[model samples]
Target: MDPHRLLIFREVARTESIAAAARRLGWTQPAVSQHLRRLERQAGLPLVVRHSRGIRLTEAGATLLRHADAIATRLHAAEDDMAALADLAAGTVRLAAFPSACATLVPTAMTNLARHRPGLEIRMTQCEPPAATTLVTSGEADLAVLFSHDSRLPDHGPDLQLIPLTDDPVRLVVPTGHPAATAAAPLTCLASTPWIAGCPSCATHLAHTCEAAGFSPDVQHSTDDYVVVQNLVARGLGVALLPQLALDAYHHPDVRALPLATTERALYLLCHREALQIPAVAETVRALQQAATAHRPQTPPAT
Candidate 1:
C-alpha cells in the first residue's frame, strides 16, 4: 500500500469528510479525493459512503484505518530512529513539562543541555500531565517530564516508557505564626484549617490525604500556580498542600513550609518506547536526571 495514500485515507477517516481532511493535510480536495480513490482500488473495497451530512466509513475502511494507524506509528518511529543514528550534534528535542517542572527541573536540564550539547535545539511547552502525556504519545513531543502521586499516573498504553527520576515530597504551607508553622505533624493537624489547593488534581490529592488521615480538607481557594497558592497562605488566607518542587521554585518568606512526610509525587521522564532510541532524547533524559538529583529533597526543611 502507498503510505501517502494511506495517510490521506486516515485523515479522511478521522474527520469523516474529504474536504476537512484535505484542509488538515494542506492538500486540495481533488488531490485528497484522487488519493482515496486510488487507495480504494488497491484495497478492492468500498471504503466510504457519501451522504448529505458527511462521509461514513465502510467496514473495510474501518479495518484499513487500523492498519494505517499502525503504519503511521511505525513510520514515525523509523524517522526518530534514523534521526538518532544520523546526528547527536544537531536536532530539535521537543519537551513537554508541567508548570512546576518548567520552573525548576526543566530549566536546569536545558542549561546542562546547552552546555553539553550546544547544537541541540530545545523546544519546550508547559502542560499538565494529561496534556503532556498525549503530546508524547502522539509524537508531538519527544519526551515529557511528568509527576504522579505515588503510582497514580493517568492511564496509557504500553507504548509509553516511564523512567523514575525523583520523588518530590508534598509540603504544607502555613502562615508564619500558625501553630503548624513551627511544628511538624501528620497532615491531620490541619484538618480543621481552611485550605488553598494548588490545582484541581492537587486539591483531589489533598482531599484524599486528609480523608485517609480521618477528615476532609476545607479547600477555600484554588489556583494552578504554586507561587499564588503560597502567597495566599503567606497572607494568612489559608494553609495549603504543595509539592516540594513548587516550593523550591518559589516560596514566599511569610509562609513556613512544613514537610508532609507521608505524601509525595514521583517524577518521571516519560517517552514513547521508540523515542528512547533517539540520541537527543537520551541526552535530554540524562540532563534531566542530573537536575533531579540536585533538586531532589533529601530532607525536610527545618520548620
Candidate 2:
C-alpha cells in the first residue's frame, strides 16, 4: 500500500469520519474516500465500518492504524534528525503537560529553551498526567511532563521511561478569612470542611492523602480546572488540596495556602525509551529538569 494512502487511512481512523479527515487534510471528501478505497484494495480487507453516527475501525483497521502511527513517527523523526544535523538548534519538540504543570512549568521551560536554542520549536498540549503518559507512549508527543503522588510512581507503565524532575509538595488551601487559615494543627483539623477536587484520578490522590491523616475529605465540588478550584476556595465555598506548583501559578489574595505536614508529589519527564535518541527530545528533557529545579517550592513560613 502507498504510504500516502496509509496516512489518509490513519487520519480517517483517528477522526472516525472520512469528512473530518478530509477537512483536517484539506482534501475533498471524495479524495479521502478514494484514498481509503485504494488502501482497502491493497490490504484486501475492509478497514473501517460505517454506523449511523460515524464510523468505527474494524479489528484489522485498529492493528493497521497502530502500525501506521509508528511508521509515521519514525519517518517524522528521521526528517527532524536530518534537519538537526544541518542546524542543531532547529527542530520541534512536541510536549504534553498536565494543566497545572502547563500553567507554569511549560512556559518557563519554553523560555529557557528559546534563550539557549532560539530556533527550536516548542509545542505544548494540556492533558491530565495519565493521558500525558499515554500521549508519549503512543508517539503522539515527543515528551510528556507527568505527575504522580508519592505512592503512584512505582506503578507507571513498564513501556515508558520516567525521569525524575521535581518532588512537589501538596498544600492545603483555605479562604483567608477561614478559621483553618490560622490553625497550626495537621491537615486533619479541616477534615469536616467541604473540598473541591479534580477528576477521579486526582481525587484519588487527595483521598489517599486525607486517609493518611486519619479522615476522608467530603468532596462538595469536583472539576478538572485548578484555577476554578482556587476560585471556589477563595470564595469560601470549600477547602482544596492542591500541588505547590498550582498554588504558585495562582496567587489569589482571597486564599491562603498552608503546607501539609506530610505528602509530596513527584513530577516526571516521560518518553518512550526509543525516542530519547532524538537530540530534540533529549534537549527537551534537559530543559524540563532545569525548569523544575529552578522553580521548586521554598519551605513555607512557620504558621
RMSD of each: 15.4, 16.7
| Per-residue error (Å), model 2, residue 187 | 2.5
State the lDDT of candidate 2 residue by residue for 1-303, as single tens digits. Answer: 798888899889999999999999999999999989889899999999988766799998999999899889998999887876446478888999988788888999899889988888889999887788777777898888888775577345687888888888878888876776676664767788888988667788888888887999999999887789989988889888788888778767788888877567888888888778877788888888888888886676322
RMSD of 1: 15.4
Candidate 2: what lDDT?
Answer: 0.83
Name the top lDDT candidate. 1
The per-model lDDT (C-alpha) reads 0.85, 0.83
Give the Å shift of residue 224 in candidate 2.
Answer: 1.7
Error of 1 at 242 (Å): 0.8
Question: What local lDDT does model 2 show for residue 12?
Answer: 93
Which sections of candidate 2 miss by over 4 Å?
Answer: 1-83, 154-156, 301-303
